[model samples]
Target: MSIRSGLFKLLGLCLLAGVLVAGIMFPVVGAAGVISNQASETVESMSSSLADEPPPLVTTLTDREGKPFATLYEQYRIPTTSDQISEAMKWAIISVEDRRFYDHHGVDWKGTLRAAISNSSGGDMQGASTLTQQYVKNYLINVTYRGDELGQQKAQEASLARKLKEARIAIQLETKMTKEEILTGYLNVVEFSRQIYGVGAAAQAYFGTTAAELNVPQSALLAAMVNNPAVLDPWNNPEKAKERRNFVLDKMVENRKLAKEDAEKFKEEPLGVLPGGPDKPASTCVSADPAFGFFCQYVEDHLVEDLGMDKDDLYTGGYVIRTTMDRKATLEAKKAAEEEVRKDEPNVANTLSVIKPGKDSHEVVALVANKDYGTDSAAGQTVYGLPYEVFNVTGAGSSFKIFTAAAAMEQKKYGIFDTVPVPNFHVSPVFNWGGEHCPTRPSGVRTYCVSNASDGADTSMSLQDALAKSPNTTFVILEEETGMGPVVEMASKLGLRKTMASRPADGRQPDPDHEKPEYSMSQKEFYGPNELAPNGRGMFTLGASPVSGLELANVAATIMSGGVWCSPTPVLEVNDRAGKPFPVKEPECEQVVPEELANTLAVGLSKDTQPGGTAASAAAAAGWDRPMIGKTGTTQFQGSAAFVGATPQLAAAAMVFRPDIPYGGLSYGGPGNVHATANGNMFGGMTPAQTWFRAMKPIMADLPPEPLPQPDPAYTKMR
Candidate 1:
């Protein structure tokens, strides 16, 4: 047959097919009427014989403070129409998937026949899909394993019955709306991955450009993907993608949609990427570090519930996440950190944690030295762990002293100058792994001036001297006298996380069994018996129970914020599609301790940086301009590190780790197997301190220097 004659015949068949569908619509009226009527009756009967079912619940995505982000899909009866799509999108899709899309009722008989015939010699059957078929497959059928609601895109499956249902729906849709409208709807609802649905998402994903800005070449490429993503996924199978592109170009040429030469040129075009990032909405990828990962996960968990979403819906659906993250501080610190971490090199894994303070916000900022910064860190690569996982477990060290001191003051354990048995605590019950006692034995007046690891000598010093020097003996005695019950209560009140401490700790008594301490500590004036917490025992003082930098920093931020509980937040606000604010509850915290307590804590932080102190190195590291007050902590094998402090403008925390990396991970890979450094030793000070400096310097540079919030001048005498 002549080309023109064949075209005419094809057009004629499509029009006739349209009429056939229309005639088949009314079960009581015409062709196949009786069978259609019976089917309707049966469907009604099935509907009437249903079991109990409620409406699909509405959930939401929210920010840290429980403000809404977006809703899961709301339309129950999935509907499709061309008006919901872009015009160019419709035309391009039609040109590639079904050249006779305008005239056909739903299915293209000639294309189906051609595909069937081609399949006889096939590796795979070429799909002869119409816009209608695609719509059915996308929303109503398990063309690729569709289940009751939405199923994860898993193993491959096909649906002949769904295709039939699609044809019927298309006939009904055609009567209800114009060909243009149906195509439009199809474009709007098409899944483009990246959590982006339809033409809108495609425009953003493909070109980093908008739907309105899509040129013919860009439009055509996207259109091709609609038919078979494997053939067009730009990331994988680029050769097949090239083939698909060329095929579309050929179709456009045949349909007079493009000139033959132009089509060739377009086909040769090296696909230029969309200028911006992917259309997928970004979310915080939490790491195995149990501290704040679970906290952030808690935020997401609540957001999903608030947004009324199912797990699948939240994971796959596009959402605008709002957070209280002070990204500037978090990232700057991350960058400054570990610039030398890799310098430590050779599989020496490391991690970092940071937190910010707010009126009702608290969250981790940086995990490692940029380890989990963007889509990269232990978090991004998912190497550290899944959401709500724990990464590092470190001994909190002297930072824990802040709480003990608070307890000392509150419980009247000892006054600042009040003398306790100022002896080096090296031989105290708390021994290191090799049965070596801490070197921090102190004796007479001069003994109190000694360090926590004093080579196990005897010395005596003032409580003030002990506080500044981190004399393990000071805290041990204070803990021994002051008691664990008050410390647990005070720590929780200050925002410390409940942790499973492995040891009864240095000076904490009434802890026979080596159980973890309890966040649930009460009743017992001591930190608690091991019975209440299987993992809370042993080292109660000296930070045997682990706490994250996030929590510690939050406590510090609260103190810095002048006793007003400034919760750390990872998000700022959550706005809707039109940028409307959602209602959220305000978070409130109590001032469990007096403001004077925070003042004293800040005092200790400041004095520690003076001449003789645990963190003299860290204090000297900073220029004193953004003058910081931070405490350092280190774990044995894993070598965990954390520092929480603030400038006048911002308050944050920095945490780093090598996972449970053998404290040996802190050493070089060569012949010199440096065992490990002091508990107060290692790079936590250098890296964590640097991380804090980097984060604070930039922020400080951006603003005018404000005077430090000085504590009460007269209250300087803790005694």
Candidate 2:
């Protein structure tokens, strides 16, 4: 062995050792870089996908007084800005969850190293996720699992890949948002328990206070629950929850966020969790106050149908709607109807609608019924709201005679002093009749025999006397003199028929013995007639047309307002999330008839409240201290009874009938059935008038009395 041989051998060994080290180190470094790049890309993609999306928030509904009545939400979260969140909450969460939350960019290397060592050593896996990372994970979970169950499960799966993705995304989020913004977003999205997302909702569910009002101990408890809500739910696991709360307090103390003594004091205090077990927001009419149920439903319907608002958006758009409902009037009207109708005939259905006729907007003060409005099977009752009022046209009975009287007066051909024939049974000479029972009639004329409530009425009387007595025969003759065209037009001007046509001047007379002659008159004939006649087959004065309670009330209101007709409205205003006002339809008003005719008609209707009048007893029973006027309507066979009345300030209408039966079937009751006792049948002047009187008394209390205007001298001169 020589010196040269020894040196070459040592050099060869060193070179071989260098090659071995390079072989192991190169692949390990390259693989680490590749994994890091993949994680970054995944995070960037996730963060970018969610950057433009807003957090899910709750929409609230408030009453006219700005009090919250209902809420629509998917997660019950009310998002709050950082300014609205308490400092104690932010510090407590940061101290316990991530001590170096503000110090770290997005990931804490020192914490990660410690977590890795702890996890690899077979201990419970230590969480090294910073608040930013947690926020990223929460965002992913929310966006992915909002409406998808499977996606939610995948978002929360315990996997290395998921954790790596969260970490990468969190780092990216830090650059795009400030620490305070990130903290605010994190607090808003973190789940504190089942179906409880965000600090705002958690505060309400757990403590009944707002997120901005949480005390130190309260915040610490909430902060502790974020780790494992089920295990630390104070209501379900008080001991575990207390322990975790104390642990969070201790961590706060370690971070100098709270004093050690303060931490000890908090630990000694009981859990003190005030949990709202379940929410009972007024989401539907059934859940609303019984008195306001129908009114609320009316407002809701107007929003969806009349205003063209999306139903989904209305429930969840976070709108703040201010309605036109007068709470006092509503409550009073409801009480009046319930006390009057519910006691006598439980089976009888009655509806009362009151409106304030305004110059530009007519507010529906109240819409009430004897039965509650709802969808519960046990709550069996029809929903009598706007739909019922505007569509379900009930027979107006004698109350409709005002139109005939108005037509004759407006034509200046007849006045309150004019005399008309009133017979116990009189048929219009215009209706053509066939069969041997019918006497010979004029050409193109019919005999439609109509009877009055009283059998002693074969007399001619002044117009005012006939009106006050509500004699069916007098109005029939008045219709004959006035012509059906002007009569129908008078009713139409006062918002009677949605569609109207001229009555035929002549028609074939039907047989007097013909059954269902009224039914033979089709809807087109009644609504879209094409000729002129003395009367609508003599039934027009008997109130054959179907009109809703609302329409009837408006008619009375029109007279009360001296002929101005204002469309009914339920909502006053609507506001958006940013407190900006949304456009709302104003009340529409138009003069339907001349003030002179309206005043004269009003004076004629007022006589019904005097002695020898049909509704005189009801008017006295109403106990009104001020002058009031109304008409009583009783359909044939007593199928329905209605009273529409008004003071100068308020107007209301009520109807009593069996909702389940057709309009012309069995009476509500007669002589010992329900409505009537003795040998008498129910009349519009009975229950309906009583209900109107009772409801109007309370409603009129707050309104100053204004005497109804006198009829103009031109119409009065005929007297």
Candidate 3:
């Protein structure tokens, strides 16, 4: 024999002796890390981790109706208990993988000795790992060294030292866990196919059944695949998989786990796997329905940011998340949005959000966008969370007028019926025009002047009438009359907190010429004590800042709920793997404004869909006769348009803007020319209000119309 061969055999005998000692002494000396220096730390550290750490499992997200729509996972695994596994599955795996599983403590010493001698002789290297040893190895690879490629390789390396390390950990595991638990853990953490892990997920993927329901033949096939999942995959190598499966069945019979006659009969049966292939369930927001994908992404962000959940745990914690998404409502809203602004309309995007209003909770029911939620930008699909986020949409336009009106009423200085001047154009005395070329006053100050949407609004009218017409000059004048601070504060209080606090990264860079670059900040910061545009400016009332469509809908919800501001939450419920209720962390509902002020504001805004109102034409077209309050907003340059409305039950906001042109405005007659003119057709009342009425008409069809609260005479009448 060669010297190398002699040395290998001698080393193998030494390892065999070490393993024998470890098998007997591991329970006592194992705690002291007396195993070899190379393996002591690895075995000791990994043993406790195996006992303490649970394997990565799948997390499912369901709609409000409790139908699962999306799944999130690091490893596509579903954990099952010993009782949840079938007897056939346990026996088949043990019979083929380790025939003397129950007879040995953890390591089968006789098999190990034989494998050691054979391997040392340079024949086909064999694995003598018991189920517990395999469990420890799998746990180390999947859980302990999940992302560490080097650590995974070390756990799987083919060496006597590695085997000794595994043996020591396995013996320790046997003392801590039962045989059934070890079997279950091994079955769960083992890979059955690409991205498919665990017996539970395997059963569902292979046979469209649960682990507990797996029959003998099905269990045998899965057990056989654990040896070589890629090669033994039934979909690709059916003949080989069948042959391996039959071998497992024969071994089961030899072990007396299955009857010989039953094994023979089962061998003739075909692999009854689910049709087409393994039923690998699609995961992540990208795989969700186009109509609901945006909302699914929104819920994911909300869970991490507001609920304080660890992002990694969210994917592997096996949580069952029940969200407030009304699938039907979401589908309908998406259909309406796409119908109004076709999904193929590349530049423009129409976004909508719906909230169920309440004093304690404002449940977000729907978030829909005209564009399909996906990564294929060329196909008119977007991955941006448009409905819930500000994104590239310019501003909410005259939507800010709602806050101004609310602020005015809250101050008790101006009532809804109190007359406010409406002129063809008005010059502001308090605000600077900045870079805009405005007419210089006699004092050489550039006057900030603004005009109404149309050329024929030179008359004084009540605040309620002015809101319906949405005269730009009136709201800007009102913002000056009512301090800008209160108006900005009202927007924050009425559910625009996130919108006002968002510091968009684009266009915030400091001047290149400046010695110190000033970073761009959020609207709230601009209105605060910051040196950049402190205390806000004149255009605040006209909604000249980017805003969240979801929060705008929540603004209507806040008003509909009589001044209570509740953070809009998508999660309805969450349960841990143990099926215990997980508490959701959300901002508490607070009364931001007086109940009477909100009620009075709602009554005044109710005229928006009435005769001669801006949204009157759209409301009439939709046959909208329900008792509702609404407001329409069109940006100064027609960059974006928005409509916010609410009933007693539901509140919604819809906006239309050019997503591609963040710093630019949407012209009526722009490229793609679906429906545009130089300055004729793009107004909040046109597309956005039409979209709102089109969606809300069907949503509110079955609900009874509830009347608004009586308007407070103090806000309705002049002080």
Candidate 4:
């Protein structure tokens, strides 16, 4: 060939290389006077603007003691700095993927020229991407183009434009970051397997080790997966995986990262991975440890509903959530609940909630249920939010009588020690009942009438005595005289806000024509003539509406805190992705009722564990001898029952109900929802009171015995 023809051919090859480099290599081609001015301008016009945000990282959830219990994430990645990574991992990856990683700025120019010439001759596409270029591509795909499928595809496409863009941005990145920084970022953002990213997660998932502890063989096996993770997966294709791993070991030997003898010895060793990979943490709240699952779920709900945080941020924003969940308290509560009512019991649920009382704010420590928190129904696991949610739960029964009592004292019309008539049966002159649940009179008008739980308690007694015995007729008449509106409002101010504001979810929209059409059930009951009861029945004191255990526990907290009301906060602190304090909307605490009235009421409630109280039997069975306030309640039709009580330190509530059949009543000594009981019937003083005593005995073992607040003479005086 002629010398001129040889130089022309070489020049043609160099110009073809400009296509991949966006004409950044035009200076070398321009020496032969073969580059166009338009191409030179195109190279100068290409921009490099890479995002500087860190990749998605795993969010951790810690308990009351700041110990990690769960992890939430969109991608299972734990970002590690260069110093935290082992030297074997760094050298092995460099040896197999990019041999001249430290020598090159961002792109391997010599390799690019050779690949361009080979491709121009119709050869297959060859890879010339340096570590920095690979880092740029991964950063765009995982962080910048996140959730944008088209943008992610465009970033990874094997086109000349994509390569040119990556090369330009990588060169700019090299200017800003050191070679070690580039390598660290690349290892942190690269996808080692489906849904698994970064060397930290990869080491744990594959070999049950950390990034800093990876040895030579494990490092070689991981480095081999960078080229094709799907094909070289050690779990599915072990032979191919071993072959690729040995190839990486050979490269490590050639690059002097490992001695030849050590490389060969590594080839003889087994894969040495855990049998089925490491045991990953519960990725979601439903899969958390049964002892802490419900509390974890409550934290999630509080973040989203109460604090106005985005639901997606829990998994993607890398927050460090520190919650007020006491592990010992929660486990004790769960054990007590399950011990009282077995988890596998048919159609029954037992839930317990614990709250720490404070004058300013209340802190929730435990929320537990007899059923395990999971998706498996056959194994007695449930994913329903039974502890926190009020939906589909049966009525709170006479546990609501505390609200009526509080309302009477707040009005200064009745004192706790005042005399009230308790009849065997009394008919209401104010309200006429509806068809099914009550009796119809001969005049075609059904007057509301109720009887006491025991015929012996028909005589007149103090309001404090009525509360301890929980007679139906006395509280029913009390509701009539105190006015249902004030009673219902008092429940809202105390803690039953969500329960009182709930409406049936039967596709019922608000009435467009009525004033304040979006009123809740409690509002309708107070205003009179609601959907269920015409002229607004007097069932408010009897706990006619569904209620939340969490709210009931907070009610006890309110009384124990001397009438102060506070939002039941689960989170103590939350740090954002950048480790800064994330501000949440704080609801101010207020004294909902007078401190004197609350303290007087607390004294009135303190007699429940004494001689003639409803919960006396349960308390005695547990060897109880504490100064505490207690109340037990059973729904009129045996649908549900509850026990709420408080000490100077902690307050709690426990309930027994039919979760599957929300409105179904419990049957005893026959074929019914709840089967095989200690007694022929189930009541608030039965399972619920027992559960509370069993749970609180151990929990209060270490707490010092403290007396409740003193009653004020103004409210304690009989009317």
lDDT of each: 0.51, 0.69, 0.82, 0.79
For model 2, residues 371-472, the per-residue Cα lDDT tens digits are 666654245455555223443334658887877888888888677766767887666675543423556564634466666787763487777778778888
Of candidate 4, the 10-residue stretch with the lowest lDDT total is: 503-512
Off by over 4 Å in 2: 1-79, 91-177, 186-198, 216-281, 343-346, 375-396, 407-413, 429-447, 477-492, 496-526, 530-546, 662-682, 713-719
lDDT per residue (tens digit) for residues 271-368 in model 4: 87778744456678887897788888888888898888887777888899898888888889999888877778876788899999998679998999
**Residue 295 lDDT, candidate 3, scale 0-100:** 88
TM-score to true structure, per model? 0.68, 0.71, 0.89, 0.88
Q: Write the per-residue lDDT of candidate 3 for residues 376-416, one digit (tens) a residue.
A: 88877998888888763467788789998888888877899
TM-score of 4: 0.88
| Candidate 1 lDDT, 482-575, residue by residue in tens | 6566666677777653232222222122244435333223223334434433222224556534454555666777766556664444445544
Error of 3 at 717 (Å): 2.9
By lDDT, the better pick of 2 and 3 is 3
Question: Candidate 2: TM-score?
Answer: 0.71
The per-candidate count of clashes, in order, stands at: 97, 20, 3, 0
